[model samples]
Target: MALGPIQFYCNTAVALICGIALWTDCSSRRISNRLILIGLICTGAVVLIEVYFKGDWQNAGGRLAAGGFASFLHGIPYVSGQMGAGDLKLAMVMGLLLGWDAWHAYMGYYGLVLGTAALILCLVPAKHKPWSLPLALF
Candidate 1:
């Protein structure tokens, strides 16, 4: 599938939020609520832009569905205390980027890969470092 500028924008935006959160957490020993909220707003704006500017993306229903799915999981993770508010914000951002078959595959593929890595991190013994998956896949 041909990649569009929005995908890059979404992924970069998410990475920026996550990186900021990770940095603030490391530096201050806490996640800033403001940062998380800002990230969510940024992500939501991107989605709205895509919907308004692009065609409804008749072929991208799968991506739309994936976005909804990720949002659902984001809630679960938040409720379970597995992820922070910034993380949920990032999910919403990425979901929108994956909109309407822009990547030719469902946006969920990105989340699945990410969640799988997260699962491995949780399940893996503390001895090994977590492998970083390439961000381009999103």
Candidate 2:
């Protein structure tokens, strides 16, 4: 799908937020709530603007539903203590921004990346294996 200017800018903002989250996760092994909040707020603003200009409330509603669904699915891992809250929030933001199909593709690619990382980590024994899969994801 071709992205319009606003969508492109929104994606850029998301990328920047992801970079910040990545840095914080790698350095401190934590993704701050503030970072996720920023991402959510920015995405909300963009969606609001789109709805205002395009008069497409249905699209905005769909985005919200997609995000909620993605968040719900990710909540399972969070509840199991296998994923961080920030990671779940990030997935929600991604679904909001990219919609369900894109979010699914992104998650598939993320799983592949995580699997490869895990395989490599297994091959090379380290003194301390990183416990944060979300951090590795970033």
Candidate 3:
């Protein structure tokens, strides 16, 4: 399907969230809590605006924000978690912005690339410690 205004918004929000998550260590720092909260508010505002001003029911931004929030909440259940709150937040945000037509094909391809890179990193030995260091390399 052709990308519409809503789709563009989704792509942009996801890009922004991903960029922030990649650059900032929201997982380890308390400051990330504020950032995530701000992000949620900003994203939620976009959705509210769209719904009221643009009559948008399919815009993915609001849903993405909620999903990101849910992901954060889910992280609380684990003693030590594998999924990062930022990553989960980003995924939900992307999903919300994607709306009903979330280009699963593209997501699948990207997931494959990420998994391959992760696998390759997992195969490598670490000098400093025994734990996996793929994230450290980046």
Candidate 4:
């Protein structure tokens, strides 16, 4: 699957969201609710644009479903205190953007990126307090 204009837009938005999230998380050891809200607003706009301007109504439901599914799936870990709230929210954003793909390439890429980060953390020594995985860098 080649990167199309829509995909580029989605990826760019996700990247920007993650970057801000990474900065705040690293600085304060927390992800602000406001940042998440801003990200969601952007996602909503993208969805609206896709549905109305692009006339891509067919994929609308899937995109929403993907976002919901991602949040729910990630929410599990969050509830258990295993994952940060920001990461869960970011995952949803990624899904909303990529879940439109018939093959779910966005979800796959998310899993790959997250899994690689986990693996790296496991291998590296943690000499200090728990270091949060900067989701944006992934």
Candidate 5:
């Protein structure tokens, strides 16, 4: 799919959010509520921008529905005690950014990413080292 202006904007923000999420998750095995809140707020702004400028109400609605669906789907893991609520909330924001129409593609792409990560982990030796958080520098 060709990247439109709004899509570019959405992807960029989501990428940044995911980057921070990766860092915190790797170091602490936790996703912060503040990060999720920021992502959600940004997603809300992007939806409003889509509705106002693009005037794509259907797409806007799809974004909302996608978010809800994502939360519902990820809720299973949360209920099973296999995953944290933060994962579900983060998926919700991601769904809002990605929209419902491309959910099939999104899932496939997401699976591919995860598969690649797993493959890399399987092939590479991992060393357990304590995180010397640079956050402590600040």
Candidate 6:
């Protein structure tokens, strides 16, 4: 699907935020709540504009539902302590920006990449295995 100007801008912003998240995660081994909040606020603003000003409520709602769904799906891992809250928030923001189709594609690619990395990490016994999938994702 072709992205409109607002969608394009939102996607770009998400990409930039993801890069920042990656750097912070790698350097500090933690993704900050402030960064996640920035992304959520920015994406929420875009969705609000689309729904209120552009009268594109259907698309906006769909994207929001997708994000909610992603949050729920990722929340399981977060609750289990398999992933961090920031990662869950990041996944939600990505779903909000990409919608269902694109989010699905992105997750498929992410799973493939992450799975491969995990497999490789398992092969070589190291003192520490990478703890942050979000950093590897970015």
> Whole-model Cα lDDT per candidate?
0.59, 0.75, 0.54, 0.73, 0.76, 0.78
Better of 2 and 6 by lDDT: 6
TM-score of every model versus the real structure = 0.52, 0.82, 0.61, 0.75, 0.78, 0.83
lDDT, candidate 6, equals 0.78
Pairs in steric clash, model 3? 60-96, 60-97, 64-92, 64-93, 64-96
- How would you encode candidate 4's per-residue C-alpha lDDT over 13-111 as one tens digit per residue? 777877887788777767777877876787788778879999887677877888888788888988998788777877777667665563365556767
Error of 6 at 55 (Å): 0.8
Q: For candidate 2, give the lDDT of residue 22.
A: 82
- TM-score for candidate 5: 0.78
Q: lDDT per residue, candidate 2, 57-78, as tens digits?
A: 7767777887998788788988
Give me the displacement of residue 133 in model 3, in angstroms: 5.4
What value does the lDDT take at residue 27 in candidate 2? Answer: 79
Q: What alpha-carbon RMSD in Å does predicted model 6 have with respect to the real structure?
A: 2.4
For model 1, how big is the CA root-mean-square deviation?
Answer: 6.1
- Specify the highest-lDDT model's number: 6
- Give candidate 1's TM-score: 0.52
- Cα deviation of 104 in candidate 1 (Å)? 11
lDDT of 1 by residue, 1-138 (tens): 555676677667757766776676555545667765675576566656656777544524545665676678677867887656555655554555455454434344656977887787789787785444223222
Model 4 clashes, total count = 0
Deviation (Å) of 78 in candidate 6: 0.9
**lDDT tens digits, residues 37-59, model 6?**
88778877887888789998777
Output the better candidate (2/3) by lDDT: 2
Off by over 4 Å in 2: 126-128, 131-138
